[model samples]
Target: MSDFQPAGDGSGLRVDLLAIADLIEPSSRVLDIGCGDGELLHFLSGSKDVDGRGVELSQAGVNACVSRGLSVVQGDADADLANYPEQAFDYVVLSQTLQATRNPRQVLLELVRIGRRAIVTFPNFGNWRIRWRLMAGGRMPMMGNPGEYWYETPNIHPCTIRDFVVLCRDLGLSIEHQRVLDGAGKAQTVRIGGSWANLFGGQGLFMLRRP
Candidate 1:
């Protein structure tokens, strides 16, 4: 086991990333796409016995990761991935970033193509809170950390958990494991939590394998 450190924000790595790490084998190779500030990659490298690299579009994010002694490349996901050979990593991670891409499906396909397993996390658009907001407010719904001005929001392909699962089935991606997050960003417990996840969970984490 490696030493653990809190994420800069002190809440530690997002619960989704921690769950994904649990699924990964020790000393695995990981590539994190759209790795803002490389928090997840840094945590995995330091605390999970994984070799990690990050691809980030923001120069500031890239610089921050590099300064932390983490390997990172400054490039867009839509473009940078083309340079990596097929199956170059054990796991390719896309956390909280799939919705921000201009081409979510294409990027997801690329992730699976470039790695044996893919870990993906994203905000759930079909949460009951969001649904209620849309139904009563007549506007795009916002909640938790995603609340922001429409013009400034990074989510380009916001989708629901059901939408994501449907897409995976349509694309022939097999889900290996999954978890949902509550409003507090903690993993929702099973039992009743799954029901809430199906209706009101704020985010989702999935481990996918190509079929």
Candidate 2:
């Protein structure tokens, strides 16, 4: 980890975000979509020596990021990204926010178009806890960070690691690396994920590149 400490109260960065940053090459330009308060971008810029910028729709999120001297734009992921030419950045990141987008595939294509590589992370809807909750209790599983009332949930495209891999195959995106996080965001016990791990892993992160 870089010596640069996060600006705000130590909510600390999310483990998944840290994991993604760990894979990034030093001095890369990064664009973080749905950047929230720019915590990850700040860390990347200050600690990892990355040139980082963000796009966030929430006014409060943008303001908070700006207050910390971060560069962020107010924009929606669903909109066109024509302003950015092909491969304008070394990396484009969409962490734990892909499921909330109006169109996941389109947004992903744009990310790859605007950057040489993309990192995406999201909750695994196929986790065993979620499956058991639905099977045994007949209820949508409330698990980990995604635990929230059904009516108020932000996830619109709940899917598993396998699902994402399949989507990548179908969309012609090449996945360079993948990682699954346990409930604590630590590496899961299972290393080789397939059908079994896909149904049990809590969250997943992917590093992708255009074919």
TM-scores of all predicted structures? 0.88, 0.89
Could you give me the TM-score of model 1 versus the true structure?
A: 0.88
Give per-residue CA lDDT, model 2, range 110-146, as digits (tens): 9899999999988888888778889999877664344
Which residue ranges in model 1 land beyond 4 Å of their true spot?
Answer: 1-11, 143-147, 190-196
Off by over 4 Å in 2: 1-11, 80-82, 143-147
Q: How do the residues 1-211 of candidate 1 rate in per-residue lDDT, one tens digit apiece?
A: 0122333455478655666677788799999998888877887887788899899999999999999999999988788797899999999998778888888888889999999999998878777877888999898765424447556677768888888988999899999888886654467774222455768776778889898
Of candidate 1, the 10-residue stretch with the lowest lDDT total is 1-10
Who wins the lDDT comparison?
Answer: 2
Please report, in order, the local distance difference test score of every candidate based on alpha carbons: 0.79, 0.81
- In candidate 1 the C-alpha lDDT for residue 178 amounts to 85
